[model samples]
Target: MSYGWLDDDTTISTDLKTTKETPFYEPIVNNFETGGYNPSVSYHYNPDVTQYHYGVRHPMKPFRLMLTDHLVIAYKLYEQMDIYKPRRATKEELLEFHSDDYVKFLETVTPENATKLAQTLKKFNIGDDCPVFDGMYDYCQIYAGASLDASRKLISGMSDIAINWSGGLHHAKKHEPSGFCYVNDIVLSILDLLRVHPRVLYIDIDLHHGDGVQEAFYLTDRVMTVSFHKYNGEFFPGTGNHDETGLSKGKHFTLNVPLQDGIDDESYTRLFKSIMEPVIANFKPTAIVQQCGADSLGCDRLGCFNLNIKAHGECVKFIKSFGIPMLVVGGGGYTPRNVSRLWCYETGIMTNMKLNHKLPDELPFRNFFQPDYSLHPNLGDRLDNKNTKKYLENLKNQLLENLRYMKGAPSVAMQEIPPDLQNLTTDEEQAIIDKLNSESSYDEYLENERYWINEKDQARKHELVE
Candidate 1:
């Protein structure tokens, strides 16, 4: 049951050789003083994630985040950016998206007592893709917390770009887990953004459909969910259909461009710009959440898309160009080595610097991207490019036709559901506040994080800022 070779330190580095031996690992401090400016970017990463295992040689390696984090550091990305090791998310915060019963099950169920609650496990699909391993709850909480923190930062106007390699668990449903996701961190993050921004756009570039996020807001126009994914019905989770637009008040608010397998970069970028240009112009969202899942790349173990690292990062650049406050998070990248490379490259994209790809041998996990010892190695069109220009064109044509239905924004009033409700994910503190206030005070009782209306993370920025 142990898969130490995949995650253990001994297997990864036998000689305990330090990065000091390698020239690339030597950090080059980039001073904005030279250029008179550095873009405001914040990154949330937790190294403790690598300790939890899914009990087999699985694709969802938590250590992938660690590799990406270190790769960013090796390239000295941390110096240009504001980075923080975030705190684990709270049960109450998680309740924003997950059901109370599901939250309770996750908090109380242990590997020892997991079999005792077989019904719960079965209901949530908490085996195989998502397993009931030791510290599974903590694993979910820690990563989910980082994403929530990032969203808060964006909402506070503190960071123009916030990155969380620990997040974008976009497939988990409200009542149960699905796909490899247990907690739908993207959903939770989007829900938090909904509090401040009148309209929020959720975009998933993962190979798989962003089912959980789409489902969570399928009935509301407040959030417009757009996903570009390989949507074969038989594929995992299998739900992002083109016609599965939002319902009732949320009609035309959802867009799914289902591409075929082996879609190359040129085809992808064209479709991305074509679809996204209109969606952004029409929906006019005030804020955005992007799921940058590296699994969409060509050489991925499970994915069939032919996007290169630069192609994957280009989507981020395009979104950033809109000048909207954005939260960028990682999702399904099965091939861990490629995941590291893709994310590291994207980190540079966020900081607006093209990093040196001629990686020295001293980099940790350098062997993963072998043969040509380069950061941006040409993975090339390894998949047969099953998608032709016509197929991609047809897909684009269909999406354009669909967007024709999305003219006027939804006019549904924001539901005034109490923060604490029956059979709901209720905030306990909110209940106490409701009880403490008198009728007059209750009439003027302001909800949401009022104290943080003008607050920000005390950013420990560069000496130049001093």
Candidate 2:
């Protein structure tokens, strides 16, 4: 079964003609440069995050986070990054993005009392798609906390990149759950980023559309959400269309690279770079939040794309090349074994560590990678590529046309950051940051201006010294 428009060379030709005739704006040069490549990465994890069970028959599984963690340890990739058992996200943090009603519902409702709260569950859309499992509220806190902690680390100039495999619940809404997502961790983390970052770019490579996060920042110009996903024929979260650009102040900020089933590695990467390069050049986001959903890989139980693990990871590598402070989080991936493989591989990429093809002999879930036991197993093509060259070119042209509306990166005047949301570092952590600043000539103090960390004081101190 294939999707996407059938071969329409004539329409493609006409579209190309109109695009070329339309006077395109000169490319905007991106100025938000990273001082230098700092591979100081932080990894957030908590075993309890992977302990909750969605349901016996449900496709969503929390155990995949454990599998991913075990592989990272087995490959010794954990040694390359600073690891922290994240604290559970408080109701206050959840309130930053989710509604108070939704937060209270998740905090109170559980499997034992779910029957009593049937009416409430229905109101919040917490049925089959998002089941009220044991310790469900706790699960949400753990994952959401990790992403918040990860964002704090970036905002404090303590890490260049942060990873939280349990985060990236992109489909969760402001007052409801959707598509197996209970909390919009991605949105919360991006909200944290916006406290200091002038502009943030959110990129989701999940098989399904990142509707919840898109909706959260749909009306804002400060955060640009770009989602690339399979969008055809009543797909899950039927959004992310060609013409579904942003509204009013957010015009042309929301970019959707809708794809068809069975897109190959070369084609996916080519299209990704083509659209992202121009978008980044124009948007010039100070920070990036990427949702790496492994379900987009080949053989994923619920996915239709034929992308292999490598192709999926290529997106991470491409984003990393930009050298922007980033937070990488996981999203949908049903096949547990492959999810572990894909995320573990991406973790290595973020840490700049090259992992071997063979699965570690000491891997805890060794049996999962059965038969071949290879890290990059051949996930043979199960669907034909319906995204033809012409179709992709048309998408690129359309997206580029949209980008032409932005004269340049919109300026964001400094705002008074809420004191509660500010990054507060401990004395011990401050010592490490001070030592790094003294040793490296990267001017960590100047960089802190970009993060707006103690901005007024830092500016005053520099002025006095001058």
Winning candidate number (lDDT): 2
As for candidate 1, its clashing pairs are: none
- Model 2, range 1-466, lDDT digits (tens) per residue? 3422212233344465554443211112234463345468999998988778888999998899999999988877766789999899988888988899898998888788889987897899977788888888888999999999999999988899999999999999999999999899999999888878999999999999999999988888899999999998589898999787888898878988899999988999989988888888899999999999999998999999989888889888888888899999999999999999999998878876666677756689799899988788877478999999999999899989988987789999886954444335577667878898786756765676557655555685346422
TM-score of each: 0.81, 0.83
User: Each candidate: what lDDT?
Assistant: 0.81, 0.86
Per-residue lDDT of candidate 1, residues 230-276 (tens digit): 88798877788898998987888889988888888888887898899
Please report the candidate that would top TM-score against the real structure. Answer: 2
lDDT of 1 at 51: 86
As for candidate 2, its clashing pairs are none
Given candidate 1, what's the lDDT at residue 424? 38
